[model samples]
Target chain A: MRRGPWLWAAALAVYAFLYLPLAIVVVYSFNDSRLNAEWVGFTLHWYDVLIHDEEMLLAAGNSLFIAFVSAFVATLLGTMAGMAIHRYDLKLLNFMALTPVAMPEILLGVSLLLFFIQVLNLTLGMLSIVLAHITFSIGFVAVIVRARLAGMDDSLFEAARDLGASPWETFRYVTFPLILPAVIAGGLMAFTLSIDDFVITFFTAGVGVQTLPLRIYSMIKIAVTPEVNAVSTLLMLLTLSMIVLASRFAPDVLKGKT
Target chain B: MSGPPFVFLLLFFVAPSVIMVLASFRYPGEFGGLAPLFADTQTLHGLTVETYEFFFSDIIYGYVFLKSIFVALATTLICLLLAYPLALLIARSPKKSRDLMVLLVVLPFASNFLVRVYAWMIILGPQAAFSQAVNGVLALFGMEPVHLLFSPFAVLVGMVYVHLPFMVLPLYTNLEKHDPALLDAAQDLGANVWHRFWRVTFPLSLPGIFSGSALVFIPVLGMFAIPDILGGTGDMLIGNLIKEQFLGTRDWPFGSTLSIMLTVTVLLIVWLTTRLAGRGRHYA
Candidate 1:
């Protein structure tokens, strides 16, 4: 059977559709002209402007801080949940682990907003954002860790136990090392999701606490700017690098066979 | 650690959602806000279908609901068509190339979704590069530049661009697990490529396709940002409508009711898909 030209053309078109807008953003970031239409010449003016922009800098800092702390907390909780579900024979525990993923972001955001506002009477800020982020991020981590744990050989733990290790010691000496890469990968993914998230953050974040996405959304609402193009380009590069590194370092774990 | 997480979920996840549902039942009184539930029998009278009726009876609301579904369905279908070949290509490529392709595909998702959508606005807007290019091409054909932004076309383009990866990754995973030798065996039996694909490959890959469709369709149904930016003033999706009720109109009860309706619809689709997939192993 002949391989048709249509198939290859279709694939190319799909790839172009998926990537062209992003490529345009990156290209325009370097365009000397402020307008997205005309490319006068190449310059680093946008990057220079971005570096001097304090608000963008602050938002970037907050985003990084949130991602790092939230990812760490979610990883710890998720690891425990994954271990409990996989190691123990509790069916209900497994169901509980899966519930968060099933819920909509809008619902989750609204509820968290209400909970913080009405019940706790706590002022919304980075703290509430981090807390809300961790809620969903943990579910993602648990999913990845559970997949890794399932594929792992149980005999490794058995061997550690036979060597006179306590359960904690066994996990530390045997299980933890095996799943460490996956845990890290999961953590990276969680961080990415947390930072990329908008709907939830839109609700949970306070009036003063504007993440980069929130800033971009507001700016877009006003009017599109070349500065936004520049910022998005930088963000796209950072996120793409993280995802590529994560995928490269932890290949088999994400493949769902551990 | 064991019991505490469960309690946390119950309090944070479960309880809040329950409150939102309960809040939907309370009526806004003369004071123009959510009134006390017990104080109003007129509001809580067993089951009041007034909210549902109001949503359904209004022609504009009904039109928006149908349009949202159509847009979502179109986006899902486009994603499916694009994803299948890409998945197959990734599956067949060398390991390094395959991994690179997968990374390339997944990497876009890491950037803020709002930013990505904003990027699309630049690309599809009146003065966008694509629009200019199209105009240039049209000038060659002695035609004029056409308005593209603030149209359904723009919304669909943004939707498909944003959600394509969600469709691709799942399909790739399922396709990656396919046995190459099975195809070879089919070839040996004198089955043509199309026949082999229809008889073997397509059936095995249906589960991924169904899942991909569900993933793409459900979220796009409630998508707020893309429609708001790309769609015309007349285009109001259910998500935008809900947003108006909650924030613009300050009608929490009506907003909550719409929320419940949307949530229920999503849950039903998920349930039906999973159930059908379970029964049909080809799809599953």
Candidate 2:
């Protein structure tokens, strides 16, 4: 069947719609003028301003710290959860592992906000932010690891067991080697998610703490500035590179198949 | 194996959800402009339905929810319109080109959510070329130049833009599975392109459409950032309202109450869509 010209045109238009705004943002970041209304000349003024902004730097520090810690913990728990869901037919485990993934961010954010201050009496700061990040990140890691598990050959485990290996030895010898790429990919994914997260971090990171997204949010809320644009461009580049690298290094894991 | 994740989730996810439910029922203390936490033993002990009653008593909160529903519905529809052609094209494309097309869709999504929204703020801002050109047209008609930023239109645009990928990915996944044989069979039966698509391909794509709708609709319903950033005076939705109750109003009970209601709404929508999609698929 002939794919018509209109189909191509429509798809192209959609692609443009998806990209044009972002392109404009990137272009205007170096526009050499405060007013993003018109481009006068290209300059690195925004990046200069961003570099000098201490508050923004501090927020970036907090975000990176939170992301690394949460991603590490979430990966450990998620790898286990993923293994359990795939190896055993535990409905409860499946539900627990996946439900939070499906839950809306705002709901999770608000609920955790309440949980921290109201019940746990945990001060909302880096610790609270890390906990919240882990809560959401676990589901992501679990999903990726589970996807990797689903594509594996079950006979490998059976063979290990037949060789008189204990369960731990079987896992250590067989599963760990097979799923390492996915574990790393999932960890990277969890890291990306934790860093990019805005809604959850917004709620959990009380008055004192500020993450990059939170800082960006407050800046945009006041009004758009060149520094905000510069930071956004940099952030977009950061995440894009991470995802590209993750997918590149873990092609099979990214594809959820061997 | 599941013990660690289960315990972590039970503490952070399930416990918070349960607390949110309880907090909705528990009384709030008048605090010094902060979330009225469990103030005293008596207030904490009592499970009063005052917050729920307060929601039911006032119509404004209900109106905000209705408006949110409307915005979410509209955004979903618009996203479907934009996403369908793109998804169909990608699904039909050669295998070599398909990944590139999908990556294009996902690349923009890889950017921070706030950055994505900020892109629109610039596009819709008065001084931007798009907004200026729009106002220029309005000037020709001798009509009042409209403020595009901080308006419902901007909010809607931001919502659709943010969510278009969600709709596309699911639809593409479904559409990619359709057999060429079915379309060929329809063509041989004297059905033209439109009829073949409407009868066979479209019906087959219902499951995809429903899943995409659920994906788009639920997130839009609870989204506060787009509306908060783009909306003018009259564009408050349930998200904005719930956000205010917690952050601005500092009323945790009412905020929790609103969240419970939002959760129920999402659950209801997802359940209904599944049932409806199931029936539609059976017929298809």
Candidate 3:
């Protein structure tokens, strides 16, 4: 189609649509006004308020902790699943790992909430949240790792097996080193996904546990405040850097292909 | 290697889904959750398809389900329209700049999505400049000012904003793969740009469009937080209803039933879109 006049305007408008809400957010994070409805001279008062906000700080801590643990477990499982699928062509494992990521977040969240309360009788708190996070995150890690594996030639593993090395040694020496970048990138991707996740975390969180997204949800629901904006800005920065790092580790992961 | 991950998924993912199905068939506990399931009372302990009956008993549930579908479809259409030009521009850019452009489209994580939605809350608040400007215009016509934050318009804006990138990425991926020579051939054949696009570009992009629509539509179908934050009281969707069962009303059975309905609806839509898109491609 044409790229000269109308196309550029359309593109500009789309960009504005995408960025304006965020610009409003970032701009208001520093706004001095309590209402956050308008700009009333720039100040870092909201940041100061966020710094002192105990509940917000606690929620942030919980989010970081959940992201760390869930990402670790999910990466481990996902890397295995990725390798297993690549090496053995396990379709069931393939579906199980990937479907959670693809399915609507609420379905997963609701199902987990039911499972926790009914079957396992697990207490809904940090462990429940971590387990839930891991469930969804494994798919992402498996996708990246499997992608990395698929791009590789089969000869490397064949060469290792041809040597005197055992299966464990072959993996430790060859496969581990080769997919480390993808694995790291996958873990980082999982980290960001876990940290930014809201819908899944919402249902599984029960009544006691509160993550950053949950806190922000409640805050925004109750009333808009610059502190929420401040927290959102900082959380965005945190996840942004994590994404950049992930991409640096494995550029194709950001493009999201196998 | 497969044993561990497979076992983990069976325990967590698959089991939960199965349990949800079971829960949907059972009665809601007198208190909430599983008290009634495990209670010594025989009647409450007995499994029934009552939740399913209750679901179809009233047209209200079906109406909400249908509304959710309409919302999802509208959101998908709007996202496709908004994302197409941007995706095209990115796909058409110089190779070096394409990555940067795509990254920019995906970069709003810098505000995170919750904050992104909250940004709308602020902008559409009654006292905010955007709302005031809108209301000021309405005032010129002697119409009543609307509460923009808790309205359907706010919900749509939030939905379109959050899901735009999903549509953009898929289209960009597809558009990037198109042969420029095809467009050039059409041009040399005296086909206008609009003709070229409508005939060639769009037909080829059906798969991308379906995939993107699935990515957007499926999620929006189950979204609760957006409507919770941005929509009015009457703006309840399937997501909010399911949420209400589990959280608000504490009716786990009904909630699970609603959830099952949502899952089924999502699956149906996915199946339909893929089939339609597949047929479209065959014709193309």
Task: Please give the DockQ score of every candidate, comma-separated.
Answer: 0.47, 0.70, 0.73
- Candidate number that wins on DockQ, 2 or 3: 3
A20-114: candidate 2 lDDT, tens digit per residue: 99999899999988887998999998999999999999999999999999999999998998888888866787777667667667998889888
Model 3 residue A109 lDDT score: 93
Q: Distance from true position, residue B230, model 1, in Å? A: 2.0
C-alpha lDDT (0 to 100) for residue B150 of candidate 2: 93
The TM-score of candidate 3 is 0.97
lDDT of 3 by residue, B161-262 (tens): 899989999999998999989999999999998899998998998888889999999989999999998999999999999999888888988998998888
Tens-digit lDDT track for model 1 on A151-225? 888998998899899999988878899988778888988888887888888878978798877777887888877
The lDDT of model 3 is 0.88
lDDT of each residue in B1-284, candidate 2, tens digit only: 88888899899988999999988887765671233445566544457789999999999988888989999999999999999999999889998887778888888967899999999999999999999999999999999999999999999999999999989988988988899899999889999999988999899999989988998999899999899998997899888888888888788888999999999999998999999999998989
Q: Arrange candidates by DockQ, descending.
A: 3, 2, 1
Q: Which residue pairs in candidate 3 collide?
A: none
lDDT of 1: 0.78
Candidate 2 off by > 4 Å: A252-258, B32-45
